[model samples]
Target: ELEALADPMRKDVSVVRKRIDVVNKELKPLGTNVQKKEKEYKDALDAFNEKNKEKVQLINKLVELVGESERLRMKKLEELSKSVDSMQ
Candidate 1:
């Protein structure tokens, strides 16, 4: 009677082990695909960040140029005002 009970339990364990092996085999390729997709996502994110940095640098340079232009315009206006006052 003990042998009979043990026999069934051994068969159940064997069946479970076989199912586990099949599941592991199926998961291998899926795991590889997940890793590949993760790498691609990381690379795209890096590129986007780099582009944003370049855009910020360009904007800063534009701001500097605009400030310089305004300063030069004010200086030219002051010179013209002095010339006009002299003629009065």
Candidate 2:
């Protein structure tokens, strides 16, 4: 009777160890998934930063172009004023 009781207890311990091993195996995949998601988030942030940088550069170029256009218009007005004065 004692041996029979020991056999059941031994089997129970063996079953518990197998379940623990399965849980350990599952943890590796969970860790991998977490790492993959973190990397994806970082990559997305980098892409956004690059896109914003391009936007800023284009805006600056547009501002410079507008300033140059104004300068040309002012020069034309001055030249027309001088021509009228000379004619009079």
Per-candidate TM-scores read: 0.83, 0.66
Best by TM-score: 1
Writing each residue's lDDT as its tens digit, candidate 1 over 8-81 gives 68878889999999999999999999999999999999999999999999999999999999999999999999
Residue 30, candidate 2: alpha-carbon lDDT: 100
Cα lDDT computed for each candidate against the true fold:
0.97, 0.97
Error of 1 at 22 (Å): 1.9
List RMSD in Å for every model shown.
1.8, 3.4
The residue-by-residue lDDT of candidate 2 on 1-88, one tens digit each, is: 8987768688788899999999999999999999999999999999999999999999999999999999999999999999999999
What lDDT is reached at residue 48 by model 2? Answer: 100
